[model samples]
Target: MIEPRLIDTGTARLRVMVEGAGPLVLMIHGYPEGWYSWRHQFAPLVAAGYTAAALDVRGYGGSDRPDAIEFYDMAAMVADVIGVADALQPDAPVILVGHDWGAPIVWYSALTHPARVAAVAGLSVPFTGVPTRPLGDIFRRAFTDRGRFFYQEWFRAPGPAEEEAERDVRGYLRRLYYAISGDAPPGSWPEKPAGATLLDGLVDPDPFPAWLTDGDLDHMVAELERSGFRGPLNRYRNHERDYAWAQAWQGQRIGQPALFIAGTRDPAAFGFGAYSDPLTVMRPHVPLVEGHMLDGCGHWTQEERPAEINRLLLDWLARPPLRL
Candidate 1:
């Protein structure tokens, strides 16, 4: 059984779901997602002898929502992870794991606080080291300047995004989950002109891929209804700031044993990641990195392929290298 706890991370309180035993494994979900993203992994992880815990990273779900965009900064987000670890394990080494936005947070956490994180794993997004160029400029050049639609760029402006998303929460979630899902038709999440909104020409599958259920969809819709999209979208607003903040730690590699898992079809796998070959791109920054590419899966790696994700995570966690 999963137990829900409101953890006081000193700065911001977060809603965390925890289960299992043995070494601590902290799970963090990405943008537009809450701790429920890791629902499938909790029991399996517990059975595998792990204290698997997932948190509602700051702005989503029952976690505290700070209004300022800057409040959701990388430092603040990473602090929440560390604070939860300190509270639960009190300086004990933690096996850090995350997906999407959470992936980078945990990577940065492990990079910045290696003493606290014994080893780390990321799903979807990979650590590409400090940004050589600001992402905003890159996005503008790649999408905006060329009059193409980019979801990240669409999210940069708070007002329009919140307004459109809040206008129809369920529909928005449906389109997003379906379009980027592995089951989507070839043209589901294709690029569009810059002026288009996120929902323009978006289609929602009649049955969301089996990985996601109506109950799961309802949970996300309900939470989003309460939280709105402003805080969540603000996460995208900080790329430039995040890039600037990382100047202090340039050229640092994640020395700890690390694993990366993502659906082969996930946009982040090749579409958005700096390098089509994740291992090649990540090797320079994360030398110890190893990865698994799930066949026919999309952006939502954990939810899309829960059983496989659990297996990979457990097996990797048990490796002798991670023990030392």
Candidate 2:
């Protein structure tokens, strides 16, 4: 794997790794992960005649880590991505692929800066329109107030989450990756009752899941240990602010060719609120929306099923669609 070099986005300096030379494909990764998360797809995308570039989002890895939680807001995150895209190829639209938080970043970037994005693909997250209410309130009502545990709430606090996770990075990564994988042991992911911690009921599997290797865990841990979990966890504290910022674009559509992929076992695909039907929710905003749900896969869709993902991407990108 090639080492990532730094690129100065107008708002933030990001560490980016590029492969091949052609139309640009800017990849964004999710929470608790770095540019390394998208390493598998870089060569394949380049082989298919596209410039595949993956970058470290702010607050993770080699990117700038702002101290305040507000710096990690969706508004700033969107600006960072737009800046990166513009810096890579000014005024030239690029295809975007993102998973987890990166998914929301690209999705919102498409809406806010439609001219900068030619085509967009979101993994593990679906664009379900602007929320009428703040997500924190909703989550609190559904989980916290109901005497249940919600991961976001547990992460909303700045220091506590960071302390626990950073204190035991290995344990945190192992338990987190395993619990969300396709092979989570039976009863390994039961719902936590009211007043339970995020780590409650989480099991760190014996040999780790097949999708993730010991080497991969080490890499993630090394990067995460450099800059505790503060910046990453701060993202959870901005639900109200994000909803407020998104109000300006209420009822706006993506108006670009888009692809959505998610693992059937991923909670974002079906377990969450009213997000079970992503296509139905996306068609209104993106007219050219095409999607696939991989069976037996989990949160790490690209890593868990790289070959199939490469084939799907090659076929889709080669086919007629929006281009700049």
RMSD of each: 1.3, 1.6
Q: Pick the candidate with the highest TM-score.
A: 1
Query: What TM-score do all the candidates reach, one by one?
Result: 0.97, 0.96
TM-score of 1: 0.97
Deviation in Å, model 2, residue 88 alpha carbon: 1.1
Per-residue CA lDDT of model 2 for 173-199, tens digit only, reads 888877777777545566888666667
Off by over 4 Å in 1: 271-274
Clashing pairs in model 1, backbone N/Cα/C closer than 3 A:
147-194, 149-192
